[model samples]
Target: MKAVASDSAIVLVVDDSPESLGMLNIALNNAGLMVLVALNGAQALSIIERITPDVVLLDGIMPEMDGFDTCRAIKQKLPNIPVIFMTGLTDSEYVIKGFEVGGVDYVTKPIVPDEVLARIRVHTQNAKLTQSAQAALDYAGQYVFCVSNDGALEWATPHVHELVDSLNGDAPCAWEQIQQLLAPWLAQGDQSQPLELTNFEPPLQAYFAGEHGSNHLLVRLVTPKKTKTAEALQQELPLTKREAQVLYWVSFGKTNWEVAQILDMSPRTVNKHLEQVFKKMGVDNRTAAAAISIRILESDEEAVG
Candidate 1:
């Protein structure tokens, strides 16, 4: 799901009054938003359980469960869902209470359709952008996470959690220990110097990528890939130093252009080195030569282990 919100821009409109629902449904639908209707808080929660809406337009006062209680419950289940309260309750306390219960915005009764639509558009667009960012991170196979200002884990990708497990070593940090480990680094704000967690073998480097939003501090985990030294590869294989370096990156599936950037050489020079690597290793193609490199690397790792 990439967290929350769908591409269709689904908006769940919850209100005890049929009048409000119909009016907003027409307005939202006319604006090209798919609207889901709910008669009360229970109905709203039920709808949310089945499908995540882009923004929840909830009535503030309803029978059984008021919008405040409903907002609290909704936040508990899906904190990413933005709830906006709409009711006749226009008092200062009501407005303040709405936000305290997780309402992102509040609109009083007799609300203009245009005003409500404007608010929904803003929240819905924000939610979609967030989903896109999370999906992009997953697509790139990145170990990244976002933490609250208090250093609590807000949201993270699966790979980031795996990195955290490795950083925990034998004792899993769970949550508290994780907060302690990350809190200090949050304050350090040093982007150039990577935060080192040396408790585990090979260790890990935490690079702060800066803030994602107002409260989320973005972090990326850097881990060393299994690679052999170019010198060691040259000595082990029937190839020169340049050929070894070329083959080393190529074995990891790097293109000739990419390998040239890493090795600080021209693309033509990289292709030339690759040709030498193939000839020396008695292989007709790069794939066959890569097989030889992988064998050498695996053997080296096995010996070290």
Candidate 2:
């Protein structure tokens, strides 16, 4: 094949075989793509950290840091780049292990140059699409991001980067820590509530918008919302902490039973608290009590503003 040059793709091939590297390099270069060769996993990682490729062609088995471990490391740092494994091991276990370590696709050895090229093209196109989408989302000003099912951030906006940096000041692997925090919420899958993560001041709220695709989740960052406390409610109304707790949920239109479920008290206990709250606030029923809470909330908002 003749080497063709054009404004095109870059592929990183990580393998310990001279023959494989030499053959693949010629094929990829001739096809108008730039190929970076890594003798082992460590070199591949070093190359990747310096210049992220459009797609990664990884070998499954190597000495010391294997393909799976290298892929895991690469994914931890930059999850957006697609990883395609070129492996001699065709066992189901090996294939599954590749997927678990974040391999998007695999080409079985003896390595077919045609097959490898085709797979690389497909993944590169998909990766470009994802990058474009991520760039658009960055300018959308909604602080949106996409993460893999396991909570590795595929792409995040500048706003998210700022937030993470601020929260994880001087902390090593802050990105990993943020991922760890989101893991449980992501584990909830589609049925996730807004995760409340607090600092010394207000809290960051992570809302699961939906899934980006079959393999990714979309998360939206809402500005830090100060949690309304039972103590705050107590101050707003001349009521006991328990009464404030009951009234807090009641203000949001919770019934006695629902309030009990939230506050972890019996319905009877919730009713008792509500009765006491009414007496203390000179209110006769739930409506009047709720009205007072609303007025207090409005006043608090006004004060904050």
Candidate 3:
């Protein structure tokens, strides 16, 4: 049987009505959840700054900062904590606004205990999965950032803002430059590309590893080993110089067309080189070749780290 986290979970309920707060508190506490209550938006923001909760149940209508404003403030401080809006507003526009302000799910007012519990369970589980993924990325020595289709910054690791600010004084400009740099790969749905950091003293070379989710482009940032020379890769593998280069880019999830752009070779030439690489490496496809290359690279990283 699958295990559900209950005892250690913390839920923050932000509402103005004493009745609503009392009902929610009683129900959530009975389920083995540690419940935190705030009478208004201001109080909720204060609580969030002090301690992080796993999930937040925010009331839509409140005095002096309403649900939308509070949720936005909460998102700015703790983006990973899921916010579920409990509102009497049945209008679709209000629901849309709730989502825009970073609400993960909505519960109509006069909340049903069972319904609210179910929604909380689902959103909390998702929040946990997201946290786990981010932790894995951190363990692997990478930072993550996500952007919307329009190139607006959605979320990023704390280190990312500092790095970006150092790169360019204006973060918007930096993001624009990155978007332009990745325009070609983005067109082809390529998930990873080498990023040139021009401002650093040593001129760090970072790779942008991206994956397209439902609405945003999720990216992982890693500083790869400086040696991408075909000669170096050829020395480690049985492949030729061009084959090694092709395999190196393939390991970063670049499509043949994108690889062609990077290597300044035609797509046909890249494919031809890949075929030879497969023959030498005894791999059936590009994915297998990439897997082998990644293993070798990760081994090198482990040895160095």
Candidate 4:
């Protein structure tokens, strides 16, 4: 049987029984989702390692490893991937165990094809949004510097501002000033660190900088680079800590009031921060702001790669 083609979602079906596997494959494929089947947990794990499916429909009973253990292992290995249990075991205790194993949902056997397809659609959509939000969060913590062909700073994340201030007594200068201030450091080759210069400054002064695309732009991150906390913070973009929080919600497509609820603030406060974000980003609306943020994030990933 052939399923419809939905380029956006990939579903992995794990069941030991050939009949059950075939049934799911037909159903999922008909619904326009790409489907992959594994007869057991071991095979499922191998498939997962090779291809990160949007969602996994796992059977509770399997040889070598049962669904719960498999689900736990998958979550540990790939925390972001969502798993849904598809099983004949409908006991409440079994359901609870599935949840404990990190299963996002449960569907009993003798499955209604429509219901299964609907649930898959819902979970896949949620997963896509969650991934996007996490990407945005990572983008917010990192340093992003776009340089012109002349080696001037076109733009820098706010964290770069902090780094510049620490490097020079009269810091927080415009992008042009930053280029001049860090000229020596920028001259360093790919493999070198600015240890000698940083040693003269505070010990906490550290940076991870890299060049991308024909050396047109240089991206730099400065912090106590060795610390775990600093690394985590560095993965985020250059937003005020609060703005980072707000941007997370924005990436999830939340309204101002919804964001306020999540942040435990009033809608007015959320709007105020949003306005500041707009002004700083030089974007007029939320859609434009989100697009710009995503672009900055994608660029950061390219620089890292």
Best candidate, TM-score: 1
TM-score of 1: 0.48
Model 4: lDDT to the true structure:
0.69
Error of model 3, residue 290, in angstroms: 40
The deviation in Å at residue 286 for candidate 1 is 30
For model 2, the stretches where C-alpha displacement exceeds 4 angstroms are 1-6, 142-305
Best model per lDDT: 2
> How much lDDT does each candidate structure score?
0.77, 0.79, 0.77, 0.69
Query: In candidate 1, what residue range of length 10 has the lowest lDDT sum?
Result: 296-305
Compute each candidate's TM-score over C-alphas: 0.48, 0.46, 0.47, 0.47
Candidate 3, position 50, lDDT: 74
lDDT of 4 by residue, 34-55 (tens): 8899998999888877777878
lDDT of 2 at 296: 67
Ranking by TM-score: 1, 4, 3, 2
Model 3, residue 202: distance off in Å is: 33
Collision count for each candidate, in order:
0, 0, 0, 12
RMSD to true structure for each model, in Å: 14.8, 16.5, 17.8, 23.5
Model 1, 56-108: lDDT tens digits are 98898899998899999889888877898898977899899998998889888
Q: Whole-model lDDT, candidate 1? A: 0.77
What is the alpha-carbon lDDT of model 2 when measured against the actual structure? 0.79
Of the candidates numbered 1 and 4, which has the greater lDDT value? 1
Q: Candidate 3's residue-wise lDDT over 57-144, tens digit each?
A: 9999888899899999999988888999999999999999999999989989889999999998999889866865675466344356
lDDT string for model 2 (192-260, tens) is 567765541235677787755446677777754345666788887788888998888898899999999
